[model samples]
Structures are given as structure tokens and as C-alpha cells.
Target: MKIKRRAMLESTGLNMTPMIDVVFQLIVFLMLATDFTNTEIERVYLPKADAAQADDHPDKTRLMANIIHRISTESDCPQLKYKNGVLLQPCQIENHWKIVVRGEEIKTQERLEELLTIEGNLDREVPGNPKTPSNKPVMIRADGSAPFHLITRVLEAAGKALVWKLEIGAEKPPE
Candidate 1:
């Protein structure tokens, strides 16, 4: 008895329709997820330094303050944006700097202090007493062109808020 083999194994091609649909779905999901997180953060051109290091608390709940210089925008510099509930529209002004936190611009140091204080107190069970020694960590991502006074103001506000665990975000200089 002669046994006949199946012809060409009936070449079954991969079903790409499901894969393409899954890929499109993933892209849509990522776009929405990234937009939510990024909208809260202002784009900052962090100062570069030799001592710049990687963040130790990558996943910690830390408040951020974005400081950018307000002047003419060059190829190297970016335009000043107003964080009015949403970081929208370019703003016109003379030589000055602006600070943004949680998509809201900190118009005054008092407001900065107030905002930080409120955020810092959120984790505390008691109004003034913190269960932990340190409140939430605060990071200041100041632009390279931003004035030193702006940075000082941010630091002062952080101090007023009693944020001891603070960090200045910087980029590593090119080797």
C-alpha cells in the first residue's frame, strides 16, 4: 500500500488582521496615557552640570516646579507659556521668568508657598504634624537660561512650605 503525503502542507499564512488591530489599540491607549501625564508637566530645558545624576526616587510621589526664562525665543531657547489650568498659548513679556506647577503658573511666591503647603499637608493626617519626618519631595526643573533669582525664589518657597526633601533636577553635561 502506497501512502500519499499532503500537498505543500496547505500553506497557512499568519492572520495579520488581529495583530494590526491590537497594535492600533495599543498606540491609541499609549497616546491618551502619555497626554494625561505630560499635560501636567511644563517642558523645561534643565541646566546641565557635571554632578547631574540619575534620580534615586524614580517612582516616588514628588511635587515639581518648572521654571523657564521669558525672553525672545531663539533656536536654543523655547517660548514662554502660561499655565492657566492648562499650559496653553505663548505669553509676551519683558525679561522675566515664570514658574509652573501642576499645569498652573505660580504668579507669586506666596502662591507658590501656599500651593506647596497644601500639597505637603495632603499626606499628613494632622494639619501640622507629619507621620513621616519629611514631607513629599520637591523637584525644581529650572531652565538653563532662567535667572538665578527665579531659582532662589523657588527654593525660598520650598523652604516656606517646609519641604526638606528637595532636589534640583539637572541634566548631565555631554562628555
Candidate 2:
């Protein structure tokens, strides 16, 4: 007796439906998880002046202060500390910087004074050589939403403290 053979067929195409689904899911997840709150700060409209490029190089003993608008039940405007470009946690700077206001309102004037005091204290403690003006440069990284008035006040206070160099940390505007 002769046996008959059956031919089998094989599929050459790959199933990409599952892979595409996984990729789309990952994209959606990342988009939802990313935080974009700070993007507005980079879009601040800074006043234009004929002023030359200010020295941005931090002094050997540079002091950085990060000013941001914080929300609280008592005060909404609080001057927070920025150390080495990082925002410090609450009550982090026990001796260096302190919040002087309470309440939800922003106290632009008082914040300036407090910042100036901190600069003065730092200058006195960390003496710079005569070659470097104000041995300790005061750098301010204000939140994008913070009013220009607040920044101006801080600059004024810095001037009073004999701080010739004032650097504002900002991102380059998009082209």
C-alpha cells in the first residue's frame, strides 16, 4: 500500500500588533508622568538693557539663593534657598537662610531685606581677596513666575551689601 503525503504551509510575516501596542502604551505613560511645572520660569520676559555681560563665574566662596513662589496657608510668597543650583528642603538652612514671613501673601520687601542680610553675613564670614570684588558673589535663581519687582528688590539689596556681581540663573530662550 502506498501512503499519501500532506503539504504543510508556514507563515513568513511577523505579528507587529503587540509590539506597536506596547510602544504606544509606554509613550502615554511617560507623557503623563513627566512634570512640566517649571517650564514657565524659563519663559520669563527679562528687561533688556545695554549692560555688558555680567560676570557669571561663581566666586570661590559664592553664595547661591534660590527664590521661588511657595504656597502656604499663612504666606504664599516665601523666599526659599537654592544651594548649588538645587532647591533646599524646608528648614534645611538652619543658620544660613530663614523665612521671615507668615501668611499667604508675598512680602517682596521683607524678602529682599532678609536676602541682603544673608549676603552681608556670608561676606563677613567668608572674606574674599581684595582682587575679587565682594569676595562672595550672590547668585539668585528666582522662579519664573516670581514678579520682576521681587527680583529688582533683591538686586538692590545685593548692591547695598557691596555685591557688584549679580547673576540670575535662566535658560536660554527658545529660538
Candidate 3:
């Protein structure tokens, strides 16, 4: 008995409409899920400065310290506290201040020390020559209405942490 075999059939072109639809859906989902706000620091009307400059190169690595007012709680709001030491719980009263380092509040001077020490020890050495890392610019974003004492405390804490280079975030006045 002889078996008959048919030749391979020519295939139609692929349809990219479904794939494009999926891609678009994924893009929309990601855009919605990802937050564009700078969550590291809360929104505040920054004080105006004549010499205030936008950070031209925003990709540089640096530690951000935020001095923000206390959260106001209304009718048992949710809160977040994790191993990273971040606290997002509502405060008993508004206008309370906090010093946060790497998403965690600065409870003590030692926490700041630990953060700096870890950053310094992270892949920054040149082979066998372990030298003091150049001062990492510590950016401080404080509310314009934030008390002057709070700013001073943050500065003093930064000094204690041995971070010399500092950048204070401010808004430019309207022309």
C-alpha cells in the first residue's frame, strides 16, 4: 500500500492587532499601578529662592532626608510600618515633624550613622585602597512652613552622620 502525502500549506501573515492590544493594555496597567509622585517626600509648597536651581542631573546617587509635617488622622486611617522603619500612620495631630532616612524615620543619631556607614561600605572602595568616601550630597526637602528648629535639627543630624555636602530643596518664585 502506498501512502499519499500533501505539500506544506502557505501560511497567512500574522495579525499584530491582538498583540498590540495586549501591549497597550499592559502599558496602561503599568502606568496606573506605578506612582509618579515622589513618595520619598510629601508635597509641600517650597520656599522661594533667587538662586534656587533645578537639579539638572537628577540621576546622581544621594541620600534623601525628608522633614515633613505629621500626618493628620481622621476616623481611624490605615498605617504602614515595616522592617525598613518607614512609618505612614496618621498622627494624632497635624504639623508633627519627623526625620526620615532611607524611608525610615530617624529615631536616633545611631540610625543615621548606620545608614551612612552602610552606604560608605557598599562597593565604593578601589581594590585595596579603602578611603573615606567623598561626602555624598544629602538632599533635604523640607516644607516652607516647617519650623526653623526642625531644619536645624536635620542639619545637626547630617553633620553628625558625617555627610558634608548638602542640598536644600526649594521652589523658585514666579517671575
Highest lDDT: which candidate? 1
Which candidate has the top score in TM-score? 1
Each prediction's number of clashing residue pairs: 0, 7, 1
After superposition, the stretches of candidate 1 with alpha carbons farther than 4 Å from their true spots are: 1-35, 56-60, 70-95, 123-127, 130-133
Which one wins by lDDT: 2 or 3? 3
What tens-digit string does per-residue lDDT give for candidate 3 at 98-148? 767657877776676667655544434342222554345678787665567
lDDT of 2: 0.51
Tens-digit lDDT track of model 2 for 59-99: 54455555544444474224454455444533322222222
- TM-score for predicted model 3 compared with the true structure: 0.57
- The TM-score obtained by model 2 is 0.38
What is the lDDT, from 0 to 100, of the residue 70 in candidate 2? 44
lDDT of candidate 1 over 1-175, digit per residue (tens): 6555665566689989999999999999988777454454577667677887788645445688888654445543355444432334433343556788887877877999888877777665455674333457788888665667777887787677676767788888668
RMSD of each: 8.8, 12.1, 10.3
Scored against the true structure, residue 20 in model 3 reaches a CA lDDT of 98
lDDT of 2 at 132: 29
